[model samples]
Target: MECPNDHILLSSGLKGEEKSYIFRPRFNYSKCTKCSLCRDNCTENAIVMFKEGYPFLMPTLCSGCKTCQLACPSKAIEEDRKEIGLTYVTPVNNNLTLVTGVLKEGEERSYPLVLNTKRRADIMDFDLEIYDTSAGTGNHVAAALEDSEFALVVTEPTPLGIHDMKMIMHLLEKLNIKGYVILNRADLVNDEHIIPDYEIIGSIPLSDDIVQSYVRGKPVVDAFPESDASVELRRIMERVSELLW
Candidate 1:
């Protein structure tokens, strides 16, 4: 399938006045006095000392954790803000829009980008906002799911998948968000007894329709609405609507 004629991709940029600040260290040559303390104590090796008795910061190696600033006895290090990522707004249709957050290359932390993306999306008008968070129950995922009313977790029927699903269930419970599970490739295994306590909303069986739809870059519900997988997905959506609306 091809994109609609009216669909357009826009430049990624920050929208609001609020900025995300990371602890990028800036050195004051006058106040430094060739102490070498900031360079000597940097665990990331981001600070390098030159023969001229001055410290230089390697931008890529810096984690912006302020370790160098705290270690600087001469108080020469100053906190500077740097752009770590960009958020994009894409209009899917008249009724739908997609907001995406992408971290800059070599940046490790994604929480700030996710937060900024959420803020950008929050300003837009929408009756419902659906968040498709990244896999795993890390702090970034938690940050995305913080204000969510419920979470629909999709998992495969496998040992490792079940273990990870349990971890996510625990995280959702801790966050006080109601959780529901949907088993993908349900026909591949008969291990339902080991499933977690979360309610199983739908079980999608392995289907060639799903595979072909994925290969064609089309949704199964749109490409093959009568297919078994699509039918199950519709049921799941109905359940979700009942719970949410």
Candidate 2:
């Protein structure tokens, strides 16, 4: 994951004091000896030095582009990759393999980690894989959707849900991936216009069983196989399999 100019290496994640490979200006300034190696080797000339000879970073001018960091022999430049979090693979009770990417608190670049998790999942053999994506239609969501054969976009029945669903639908269309909408709190709003064209794969009511299962770190499908939510989830998975395979 080295950036082209060799200034930055794509970090796997931070471990204890070890930082990720992305360039963090704050850390760079603190560690730099002002040897001007970064300035001399900078391809984009994005680095600006003060009269005191300290480097000033203009991230807007920066393409996230790593050129200056590579030229610096001091190795002062670093990134917050560890802050992004790591991808974990765990085996659940029903032989379901759970691949999860937990973002570090206050970390901004969540999608890259999600992308990494998905890539890891691709290499492992499993009967079924489920991605519980972060809320919102952003880069993280987009990256998660990239390799997914099918997507279950869960939403509530409200103006906000419809608005977000439309955005996600547009994204899915752009990616040429088909998805089904699952109304989580179906009692809140009307279904008349929510997902008129697409199939309503399944619905989960706002119920205590769902909440209790989630609190106990259990999938509703596995926790209560006979429950309505569990039955619907299985049906949705079946439909998704047909669409994908």
- TM-scores of the models, in the order given: 0.78, 0.68
Clashing pairs in 2: 7-70, 14-82, 22-79
Off by over 4 Å in 2: 1-48, 56-67, 70-83, 125-128, 194-196
Residues 135-200, model 1: lDDT tens digits: 778887898889888998888888888988999989998999988999999887776677767789
lDDT on C-alpha atoms for all candidate structures: 0.78, 0.65
Question: For candidate 2, lDDT tens digit of each residue in 1-245?
Answer: 11111111111222222122234444466678988766666666767877668887665344344566666778788753234455555543356555555555555666566666677778887756666666677887788777667787888888888888888888988888888888887777755665556768888777677777766556666567888777877887787778767
Error of 1 at 98 (Å): 0.3
TM-score for predicted model 2 compared with the true structure: 0.68
